[model samples]
Every structure is written in structure tokens, then in C-alpha cells.
Target: MVNVIIRSNEANAAATALTLAARDHHVCLLSDKVSPGLYQFSYFGEPRNEVLRAVDELKAGAPVIGVVFAEGEDVQAGMQDVLRVASPQLMVIVGGGITGAVEAAEAARRFGLDTSSVLQIGAFLFGGNLSSVRAEKHDVLAGFLGPETPDHLVELALATFPRLSLGNPAAVALSSINALFHVPPMLLNAMSVERAESIRFYVEGFGDSVCRLLLELDADRLRLGAALGLGLVPVQELKARYSGPDAPKGLSLREQVNTLSSQTAALPSSFHHRFLRHELRSSFAPMAALAAAVRVDVPTISSILRLSEILLEEDILDHAARPAQDFLNLMNTHSLSIN
Candidate 1:
């Protein structure tokens, strides 16, 4: 049996992995909170350096096959240090939020270490709410989306890993801001879930960059969604208005709706049907609107943010928004078209 160490600040991160490890292998979890068990380690959120030292001591007598870092920052630094000091048999698995996973994966690649990220996006999109949404090729499609690496590093961590149970800090921040666009006016007036899900399918179908941004901001996004429940403002008032060099002169929040509406007219009529008609009134649109608003400074996200509102009305900025474009370029698939 391979010995595995599951590490993270998020309670569920360790808990979820521990559950899986205990059921599958001779796995043990090291966490900041929770109880000791046949396969658990209780901790107080120790520093990365201290964690590294502990791993070193543990490896002296026994073989540690894999190290799974599930939460906190400085993940790249921590993983790298451990990789350098730990026994050569160690394989690292990073299962944190976007930044932590991205940074750790990149660092592992730099040192030529074996690693992968496990998000349940594919599973949830294809598996969850099956009765609510009809999809035929769900499992096959879900398993297809993987990391975007040219070096050919990513392999299946598992066919299905548990979904991220609690929101990570970065996810919380991104999601919070993305929720502003879905406020009252939009919800009470023109919301349409079908269209919103359609747009969501489109964007998430694109790839990692958009999805990473969404996951990193999930908590904040949901919080912003709750704000709309309070009935604070009109939906039209929540539209994003850009002020960058590409934006028309003197645009501000007050003039957001009118300016954005007029700009929508200039887009291809196909856009109105694919997005605007459907998303503009859905819960998803508002979320997309928030992403557009917060990322008003970034033209790509801004455009996607606006387009998402047009498509689903919700900010379905997760992996489905623009799957083919974002990580498709990096993936090794024949269907790498930027659709």
C-alpha cells in the first residue's frame, strides 16, 4: 500500500481526500483542524517551512509515495522545497483553488515533477442535475477536459474526485464580484435560466483561463448574488461599462445600461439570439455582468463578461464559458478549435 499525505487549510480539502485515501489506499491526512483517526493528522495551520520539516522526518523511516497539497498559499514554494528534500518516490497532487493549483502545477513542471489538478467541474456539469438538464455524452465529455500543459504532464488523478466542498479564498473573491451583474432588476424582469445555462455551456466549453478566474472568484460571486436578493438596484443599472482605451469616451457606472445596450446593437445579430436574448434576463447573466464589471480593465474577460450576460445572464465563467479557447491551445486534442 502506498502511503499518501493529504495537506490543506480548508477542512473539506483534507476531509474529502482522507475519505478517498482511506477507502482506496494506505492514505493518511495532515490537516489544520479535525480529529485524529486511523488515517488523519491534526494540525494548527503550520507554516510551509514547518510542514516541510515534518514531511522530511516522516520520510526518514517510511516511504511517502505522494504529497497532496489541498489549501493555502505559498503552495508552489512549499511543494518545490518538499520535492527537493523528500524521498525520490514522492509524487505530488495539488487540489486547491485556482491560484494554489496553478502555482503549484507550474512549479512542479519547472522541476520536472509529476503532478495534476483535480476539479469536479466536468463531473458536476455532466453528472449533477441530470433530471434538470439533459445531456447524453455526460461522462465521456466530462472526463475529456484536463490540464493545459505542452510538456504532457497531466494524467488522470482519478475518473471522479470529490467536488470542492467549501469555497477557497480566491474562489470567494472572484465569485463575489461576478454576482453584482445579476441583481434585482435583471432577476425580477428578464431572467431566463435556459438561456443562461446555454451561455454557461458555451463559456465553460472554452477552457481554464476563464474557469480559473471564475473558481478563484466563486465565493465573492455568490455573495454578490445574495446582494441582489436584497433588492438593492435595477438590473439594467448593474451592466458593466468599460473606461479603458477601447471604451467610448467618458463612460461611467451611471451610463452603463444605455451605452452597453447601444454597443450590443453593433454586435452580430447572431449574438443577440445566442446570448443577449437568453442570458440578459437570467440569474447567470447578472453573474457574468459582475465578472465583466470587476474585470472592466481586462478586455478579454471584459468582452467575455459582457458576452456571457448576453448569452446566459449569469456569469457562468467557469470552465464551460470558453473551453476551446482558453486551455484548448495547450491540450493535446485534435479538436482544438477556438470556438
Candidate 2:
């Protein structure tokens, strides 16, 4: 029996399940074994049915684990529904940025979830999607957040990926390279975005200048972690950890971008894509708030949040209340472990 049943609306995160299901194959097709039309949410489309706009049912062991992987906004809005249906032994939010992870963890806390059993773990790994990044080429760095974590749960989580479990979920979230890789390209290449130009984002937009911006953003997150007494992973370090065997060590941000071109060749047609929408709120805004609470100013993060706010037409910080002191404390707690 499957120890946990992972669920997701995002193709990449949901692909985590597919990777597990098709463990032996380099590539797995849903149609190869299962009828997509019958089991999935054809109501939306195959891409989303994998996780979102619908769900799959199973009469497995009662009180099973449930994992949600989708856009942060969607996860934030639909977590209640997920809980009602899954009533899982464990609830894992797979793709929500640091903010979503914290928010979901708080919600679970408020609901009086027993961390020992019905635990909620907010985690996001860079490459869980086998479709986008092959298991061989892909890199995994999963960070988890929740109280009283059990070794069995950690093992169960590791069973889902082929990488080590990075400690302290908050540190993992703050160290996410997604925001560093995405926000800069969106703002710097706003013109191409406006034109809806079908150019490669990383290769074209991820120039030396953009890479510098990415480093600066990463620096802010690292600073926030430092202020909280946690030392987050540096971008180059994460890149090396997750990089394929052929990948070179000590790559600069630009070199890393070039190395990742194969995975990031698919670019969004508009700035209205998730890179801006998801990362800005999930990673940037939350980091900014934490930076404020810890008194570590993140001018770059702040500027991007503001720019995306104007572009997305919303005050991203308003999504969550004042940065919870506990938030900084959590980071502090993890920082101590890493220190």
C-alpha cells in the first residue's frame, strides 16, 4: 500500500506523484496505464486535472496522507476543501512558497492538528516534476516546516523524491532559487512580456545583469535568515547540490542559468505567468515581511514586490497579516540547527 497519497494541481508538483508511480520508467504517460478522461478532471483539461480543478478518489487505508501542490493563491483558497476531503493522517502543501507554507502551517495549527499524526508540512522542492526535469537531470532539495517532526514522516517524504531532506522548512522556503531566478526576468524584460514575445526567459532575459539581481535578491533572503540566526543556502551551493553530475561546480548565476536552459526553455507568453504571480507572493512578499520583522531590509525584494503589486494589481503583503513574530522565531529555530 502507498504510505502516502500525494495530490497536486500544479503539473510539476503533481508530477512528483507520477515520478513515484513510474519509478522504473524514464518517462511515464498517464494514458499508458490509466484512463485520463475517466479518472482526471476533464472539466478543466489534462494539464490541470493531474491535480487541480478536480481530484481522484481511492478507498485506501482510512485517514491517509494528502498533499496539495498548486499555485499558492489556489492552495491558500482551497486548503479547507482539501482538508475536508482528505482528512489526511498528514497534510503536505507541496508548492506554496514560504508564505503559503507558513499560512498553511498556521491554519493547521489553528485547527489544532496533532503534529504527530495529522501533521501539516509546508514544503517546496525545486524539481519534483519529472516531466519538466528528468529524474537523472533533476535535482531535489526539500525543506519542511511544522512542529515535532517525526523521522518516519521525513522518510516518507524522502520516498517521494531522490534527494536529501534539507532541514527547517522555513530555511528551505527562504532559500528557494525560484524567486531569485524569476522575479528579475519578469521586471527586467517587461517589454518582451508586454509584447508576449515567445523568447526564452532564462537564456535571453537571464543575462549578467539579471543574474546580479538574482544574487542580490538571494543576498536579502540570506540576510533575513541570518538575522533570524539561520544560514540559508547560497544559490550556487543549491545549484551545485541539485545540478546534474555533468553540471560544473561553482557556477556563477549566469552560468547556472545557461546550464539550466534545457529545463527553462519553455517561457511564458505573458508577465501574467506564475513566475511573477506565484513567486512574488509566495517567496518575495513573505520574505519582505520577515525581513521587516527581523529588521533586515530587503530593498530589492521590496521593489519587486511593489512592481509585481502594480503589475498584478494587488498589495501582495496584504494577503497575510503583520509578519508573525513566530515566523521569525521559526527561522531562528532552524538557523540554530544549521549553525
Candidate 3:
């Protein structure tokens, strides 16, 4: 049986769900510890050097197949390093932060191992009164399948910027492209000041991290624009789900709403682009990337979320919401099913 480890602040809930699911598969608890062996590890909260050490220990005992970060970033580099150098079958899933995932993906690609998967489950909108308490948050996870994250992610970067290079352009483009994974839902949340502020700090951190990464690469103006152009990838996915399959419909989940709020603030022009339909075309790829992080709430995400409301002039909270896709690709879907 394949060993499975699940970790999260919401551990009880995840454990409950996994217990039911594990009846059909071998599920091993990583939180308390039972044995030294190969396992599928999952957890949330801040990343720590100790966690990396524990992971190294596990690898020392047996091969690790996949890892799920519930909510953290501390040991990201260490985790990525190990995934690159030691285990090729490792997979990682994180919440909705772009910086860590980007670095991980780049590291994995550089290592030449191409079978990793990342999943951005939901948005991290902090303020608005949301409908369902459970819906307000999500569990971010990762699974490793090889020396590096799947080559498909790199392909996605390329597809998002057919005209850009794999070097500087990829760095900026990937940053923009990954940014959207965190915005749309947060806009709809509009919960409260404390919550918004909390999420804002995270957003700022992620944005700064991406910007810093680009600066390190010496990314130029055009590269940034190309990255911005990549931002639309996640927005379009949001549009397809809530806005409408074809006509850019109104928001759809009023029934599921637990709370509601209204805001009348005007944002800077640069920030306003997330809501504009035309701008969506420009942000094509970055949006998907932002969603693929360690945590899901942030400010750039709020800007995008706010834009949707501004452009549509409609309350997204008062509509029928559909189920969002669970995985980005079928391979990811299947990987989730593996014992």
C-alpha cells in the first residue's frame, strides 16, 4: 500500500476526509509518526527547517513520492533542492502564492526532472463577508513525480509567451502568469478590514517576492509587459466559471453566501487592469500562476477581484456558483487517485 501523509491547520477536517478516502487506499499519518518509510506527505502552516530535516530523514529511510504544503514557505528552497537532487518522484502542491511555486518549478526544470504537479485551489480575498465558512479557505498541496516539476508547466510558460525566450522573458512572464490564481475569489470575499489587512500582507509579500526574483534575473520592461500579458490565464478561467461559459455572465453564488459587504474605493490604473475584460486578454497567463502558490490570499488578488465587480457592475456574491476544477490537468487528477 502507498503511504499517505496529510498535514494542515485544518488537520481534523482533512484527516476526517482522508480517513474515508483511505479506506480504499493506504493512509499513513505523518503528523504523529509511525514508521520510517516512503510516503505521500501533506501539511499546512509556516515552512520550517525542521520540516525539511524531517523530510530528508524520511527520504533517507525510503523514497518520498509526493508532498502537500497546507500553508507555508520557510523551507521552500530546501524542499525544492531535495526534490531536485534526491527524489524525482516527489510532487508538491501549495496554496495560492506565486513566488515559491515559481522558484520550485524553475528549480525542478533546471534539474531536468519533469513530473511534478502544483495546484491552486482557491482565492484569498480577506475582507468581505463570505457565504460559507468552509468555502472561505482551502488546502494547498504538492506532489512530486520526478526530479523536477512536470515539463508541462514550462510548456505552459512557453505557450503563454510564444514570442518570449525561456530566460528573462520566462521569469517575468511566469511571474505575471502565476499571479491570477489568488485574485478573483478574494475580490468576491470582501469580508472585513482585519481580514483584508491580513490577506494584504501576504499579497504584498508575494508581489514583492516576484518582483525581487525578476530583478535578480535583470528582467527588462518588455519582459514585465509580457508577464503582465500572462496574467489573464487565471482570470479567463474565473470568467468561464462565474462570468459565464461564453457571454461573460454575472456572478453566480449568492445562494451559498454566508455574508456580504460593499466597497466604493477607486484603485490605481495599473491595479484596475484585473477587472477590465480587455485587460483580461493581456493578463492571459499570469493569473493561473498566482493561484498556484503556498497560500491563497493577497492584494494584487483583491485588485483583480475588485475589477470584476467594477467592470460587471454587479454583485458577484448574489449568483449561482459552480464547482471549480479540482486539478489543472488530467495527470494531476490521476495522481491524486494513486495509492
Q: Order of candidates by lDDT, top first?
A: 2, 1, 3
Which is the leading candidate under TM-score?
2
- Residue 5, candidate 2: Cα error in Å is 3.2
**Residue 202 in model 1: shift from native, Å?**
26
lDDT of each: 0.33, 0.58, 0.31
Model 2 scores a C-alpha lDDT of: 0.58
Per-residue C-alpha lDDT of model 2 across residues 1-339, encoded as one tens digit per residue: 343344444555444554443342121122122333222322112332232112344534533556665454455445565565456555666555576556665666666664333222333444444333243323444555555667776665555444555455666666656667778888888888888887787787778988788888888877877876666778777766666576766666687677663445556766668888877767777777777665778898888778888877777888644444446655554445323
lDDT of 1 by residue, 78-185 (tens): 555445545434444342222333444455567776433322121111111101111111111111122342222122233223222222222222222223332222
The segments of candidate 2 whose C-alpha lies over 4 angstroms from its true place after superposition are 1-4, 24-63, 76-82, 110-112, 116-139, 249-251, 261-264, 320-326, 329-339
Q: Which ten residues in a row have the lowest lDDT in candidate 3?
A: 319-328
lDDT of 3 by residue, 22-44 (tens): 23323333333233233233222
lDDT-best of 1 and 2: 2
Q: What is the C-alpha RMSD of each candidate to the true structure, in Å?
A: 18.6, 6.0, 16.1
lDDT of 1 at 215: 36
